[model samples]
Target: MRFRPSPATVAVASLLCLLVGLVYLAMQIRTVFSDQLKQEYAGLVLETVERAESARDQVRVWQQLPVDHPADASGYRTARAELARRLASLDALMNASPSAVPQVMSSALSADANLTDTDNLLSNASSYWRAQRDANSADVRVRTIHIARTLIALAALLFCMLVTAVGMYAKRNRLLAGQSFEFERASLHDPMTGLPNRRKLLAALEEAAATPAHQASIQKIAVLYIDLDGFKQVNDSLGHRAGDEFLIAVSVRFRESVRKADVVARIGGDEFAVLIRTFSTEEELADIARRLIACVANTDAQMGIGHVRASIGIASFPDLVDDYRRLVAAADDAMYHVKRSGKNGYAFVTAAGRSAVS
Candidate 1:
């Protein structure tokens, strides 16, 4: 049969997608902020270089005029102010720099400081034509800032790819989880009957018995071992397809007749089991057994599905040795007694003898 996602699987997938999408969003935002910070720092570096160059040019003009000229002093003050502005820009970049970018920023700052020294030397030169123009260290710093900006761009690109990859992985895992649940459903459950198969039932029984009765925190356990009667004749005459439909109907009735907390399973073919709890008396046990018979008998009367009667047997804790091995043994023996006495009745073994229902 074709599979659809169960409600449980769908909810889990949605939660996973939401969490991954949120993580991806966080990554994108971080990259954007990183890029913006890098751009602002690059602009500040360029501004520093420009102001330093302008100050040196003014100093050159002052040297050409006169050492004692009023305009020469003004030119010197302007150069100094430009120098102060360059220093302020440098300080700001240093303060706001990311820890990861410290090495690059430190190297660039060294180059910028060397260029400022050159500008200061130009201001104090004795001869106008003998100004020394050495290596373009500040320009190299500017190129390095451009290279640092490229790092930001590259980081953003890589972050985008990383987010995309993680999102795809999350979606793939969600799909696989859904597929696993589908496989489990097909394996452990009888699709038409909606009851656990023999394998699953046996496993459940084993797990239950592995824990002590005291650990169960429950007292007085009761088991209803059920086998449907006249099922084969119905299948042989009405066809297997009709027989399946009948079994489905019977399965629904069987479930409805029991307490909600009971463990019900189709052991194989027409045999079923129910583990009912908290039955502290024989009357309480017999009540449930009678109800099971009534459910099948009424279902047969109403649906006419070829004698919808069930042979049921009951066994309880303490009386059945309070262990899985003995409890199953007691219920099985009672079920055999029910089958032999008369097919459409219920039985429970006692210390005296078997008690069979009329």
Candidate 2:
């Protein structure tokens, strides 16, 4: 029979794989998001520079415009409205990263702040300058408008960069979650048999014990320790590869006989273990043992050598030894007894004494 990894081993491996993959993905996400933010921020800086130049010219023109010109009033009104719109855009950009905003955006906002103040001051001075028929109103207006326009473009750049960064981060998180899932699957299963390995079996046993008692009785936990007969002989006679295949076939047969709640594992080599919970009586336990023995009692080793049989030992918590260690030892001893007597059977420690069947 081909020996296979216990379910616990498979699970542990699967979980480990998933965890590592998730960590990798998380790291990737940080890199992706940061890079995206940096590139986007760089583009925004270019736009801000251009807009600032435009606003500067507008401010200068406003200052130079002949104050006596009737259109001066209308142009001033339009400049004021444009200034208000630019301020709103700047506020939006700064608000995006109250604490996390890029340094470039911060410097730009400060520069824009001076322009904002200039615009406010020009608004107040406009009325007076026009009354005095000043020649510089148009130039002042042109300069101020340039600054306002620059800040608006800067605000747009910052806002877009933040949005892109968030999107990249979110995508990376999703990738990490998927990797984690795969890791978990690796942690709890045997790679060969795809069964619950030793770790998973132990966990399942503990969980079963914690459930409500069956039929008003406390739950009973059983470990059936199985030793394949003539396993070594087969390894010696046939190639290890064939022996491995045989063990695998035996494992499949053994698993097919058990309920889903029951957990089975190959500890290593030719030894296997099955854990059962909530058996109502010894008879229930006996029936399970019989099923297992029948499953493994092959008439040949597939190559038609001698028969393949097994010795099974059962130990139960509370009835056998109290704790986990003793329980396993008791079951192991019983299994040995079965092997010593005759191969294809089971043995269990009972209050009456140890009992074995050939």
Candidate 3:
């Protein structure tokens, strides 16, 4: 059989997957935007580095100019203006890297205030800008790889969610088609012994009664109401936990004694009801009741409970009771008779001064 998860399990898992995927996707998108901003800053720094180099070349040209030449005055003023513009550009770029480059450049400019030696300052500024550019590039590369992996992981999560949705759809279809009713069955079943509860047993009786005689293979129905003997004493002596285990053990044996189509139900604490859907003769029903009694009687020594037996009351439809609804009540009354007149025995309901075969 194919495995099917419960509806609640699927719902919780889907919610968790969606929550985690959304949070991770949001973080990755934010990183992508931050990386873009860094790239822009790195580009601006590169432009500033070029401007600084050009300014350094211009300074060298001014230094080589003839000091006493006729064009020396004009050439000096033009070179000074160009150098000032480059310095302004470098200041703007310094914002991208901050404190270190700007502070070093300012100190160098002051030390070479006469413009006699600026190569050291320009070289230092260029080196700092190059370092900033390289660092930004490395960061972008690493973030790119990380974002790629994040996308792949998100894709995988999406695929898993798709598969889950498909499974949920298939499960829904199965339920609609009446192929599976585990949830419904669970509601109608005893959690302790995994047997049908009183509600399920009643429902089965109703369905059986509703069936047409021509459609139903077996037209007869019987109910056996069983009460455990000395069960309360076991609970009092060995504790409730042991009593519960003993009940489970007894239920298993009772289940084994019945046919596959028959239902064994736990109607109350220390009380059970079995539905016999098909039986050929009254003797067959007696043999089943005897087997059930033997099951409980033989289990006492093995469970260390010491002599716990069953007092069963049998009721059949169209024989003891006229109505199907009266079957359980009639059987319950017969069981009490056994309980009053010495427990650990079986009795059948009486009708018209005749006892239905035991």
Candidate 4:
């Protein structure tokens, strides 16, 4: 049977895929920018070379004039001065981009002692610059091809992510009407992982809230909202069967991590919630969160895939919120905060404020 992935898997995968695409896009942009700068520098050097060639021609023209001509001496001096300035600019360009232009040509041009013929020096310099420019153009073309391939890959990943999200959303919608509003004593559990469902979790929360403070045996009730990280990638790379197996394996770890009195439920796709009915100290809750994270983190070896992490949000009764009903939402929001700041960590929603765990 072809296994269908859950909406939570698609959603997390889409988000992470988008992030990867953005990073690749940014790197390509930087490469293109650097290439553009190189092209600009090459153009500047060539332009300087052209101007120097023009000045050399001017000097030659003045040299051919009659020695006794009225403006011959003055014109020749002016042309030579212009040629000297252009040569200096060309030398600077050559120094800046020594790798682009041939060193032999630059050295001969600078000395002007070896190449006595002005025309020969300018012709050789022009040829060398054009060759260098062509090479640079070829390199740019190759890089452009690589960038195009990357963009295409990015587009494909995004399109798949979107389709998966839509399909999962529709599947989620189909099951919405079947959800029971009031939690019944009859065993309401998740079929796939054999854990308690969202309805059962809510029922437990309602029961905890309904209990009178005077008769309450437990001092505090805390909810740990957990969302698995990197599960989407694992699902995509491995088959859906592997994904299901992975979830099952993780659920087992979660079940083992909590106390018999505590409730662990598969509330939604790729999301789990733990109802800690009682805890002696805040550290106890923190320890539970740590153990949960470690459980997921260790899945990499068992699943033979890359690392998988968890982000947890903790909301305690009378400590974070006065009402136990708001515990789930508050805890879910706190878990999202962990996702935003950075995944693979847990955070708490307390009366003082939200504080993240390392």
TM-score of each: 0.55, 0.51, 0.52, 0.47
- Angstrom error at residue 323, model 1: 2.7
Which run of 10 residues does model 1 get worst, by summed lDDT? 126-135
**Superior candidate under TM-score, 1 versus 3:** 1
Local distance difference test, per candidate? 0.65, 0.65, 0.78, 0.80
Model 2 Cα lDDT, one tens digit per residue, 76-127? 5566455445444544543453235322233333433456454443343334
Task: List candidate 2 stretches off by more than 4 Å.
Answer: 1-187, 211-217, 298-306
For model 3, residues 1-358, the per-residue Cα lDDT tens digits are 9988787787788678768867876886677677567656767776776776687677678778777875886776677677766766666567546335544356444413545435665666667666766776677777678768777877887788788788889878987767457778778999888999999999999876675857744367899999999889998888999988988998999999998989999997999999998677767878888998998888898987676889999988767677889899998988888888888888888775233434
Q: In terms of TM-score, which candidate is strongest? A: 1
Clashes of 1: 0
Which of the two, 3 or 4, has more lDDT? 4
Q: Rank the candidates by TM-score, best first.
A: 1, 3, 2, 4
Which number leads on lDDT? 4
lDDT for residue 74 in candidate 2, whole number 0-100: 70
lDDT of 3 at 346: 89
